[model samples]
Target: MLSMVRRPNPVQWLRYAAGGRLPDHLREWVLRDVTTRTWFLRGAARSSLLVLPLSSVWLLLPGPLGLRLSLCLMALLVGYFYSLAYLEESCEHKLVKHGYRYGSGRATRNAAKDALEAEAHARYVARYRN
Candidate 1:
């Protein structure tokens, strides 16, 4: 299954991050990328890549070292909060940009979540209700 999934190399990934679309061959990977269990983490990491450099500039301003560090940390936290708040929409947008229909990514993610819940419920029934 892993071999069937062709991942984008670093350069391609950077381009994709910059709003470029991947080739048709990588569409499946794009769907998996936006729908996987770690999608939130991936989104947060991408958000940090944008936020970190801008926040780091605060260090160059003449200020107390602790103050500069605190400001940077604050910026990071605020950016992360907004990123999470918009994560689902952002992912759906990416899917659309990659040639997927709108809401497919959300549907896929929800399906996987529902399957997990169903499996867990079955286990609970077997252990406690039976």
Candidate 2:
């Protein structure tokens, strides 16, 4: 639940604060944990930062309706997925900064560690291994 939000670095805290205003109680909770910031990117604030160029497409594609449509669709998808990727990536820095991860990447380090440890187990039966 809370893992959905990774604490941000001290320097990046400004980015979170700049996005929008939070209620006093909520703000207190966030400030309570300097380890990570709420990744709750507000509606337009975060999405506005998306790198889509639909305006350029309209300007450049003066003809070919199908091509333009396809390009527009592609741009929408690219921007959508790119923004999601950015959000996940933005949270990833917490793994190194705090020795813990949050958001979608949370437990990834633990999972990897578990996998590595499993590989070293010496009590498993041959049939179980297979």
Candidate 3:
């Protein structure tokens, strides 16, 4: 099923990062993106593209090289910390932009997690409660 879903090309992804929408054909791919196991990592990577350029400007400030580098690292860390704080909301917004309901992305992820927990409990019951 996933094999049939087409990924966005680099240009399309850049547009996506800039808040543009993809075509409807990529809707399933969008859902998978927001619900996958690596969704948090993917969100961090996406946010880094926006954060990196801004942080890099600190390197151009007039100062000792070590001081400039330290400021750049501080800015990068702060940017990433804020990005992580809102990561789930950011992913949900992506799903909403892709035409899904507001909370559907989180719902889908929770459903997958619940299924795994249920399967684990079933295995425990079968082994110990029989």
**Cα lDDT tens digits for candidate 2, 1-130:** 6655445554455454344333333433343243232343432244544444443465376778878777777777776676666655544442334344344244543565577678666446444776
What are the Cα lDDT values of the candidates? 0.87, 0.49, 0.89
The best-first sequence of candidates by lDDT reads: 3, 1, 2
User: Which 10-residue window of candidate 1 scores lowest in summed lDDT?
Assistant: 11-20
What tens digits encode model 1's per-residue C-alpha lDDT throughout 1-130?
Answer: 8578999999888777656788888999889888999998887777777778888998999989999999999988887788789989988998998888999998999999999999999999999998
Clash pairs, candidate 3, are none
Ranking by TM-score: 3, 1, 2
TM-score of each: 0.88, 0.34, 0.92
The C-alpha stretches of model 3 lying farther than 4 A from their native spots are none
Model 1 ranges with Cα > 4 A deviation = none
> Model 2, residue 8: displacement in angstroms?
17
Clashing pairs in 1: none
Instruction: Give lDDT: candidate 2, residue 93.
Output: 44
Candidate 2 Cα outliers beyond 4 Å, as residue runs: 1-45, 54-59, 92-130
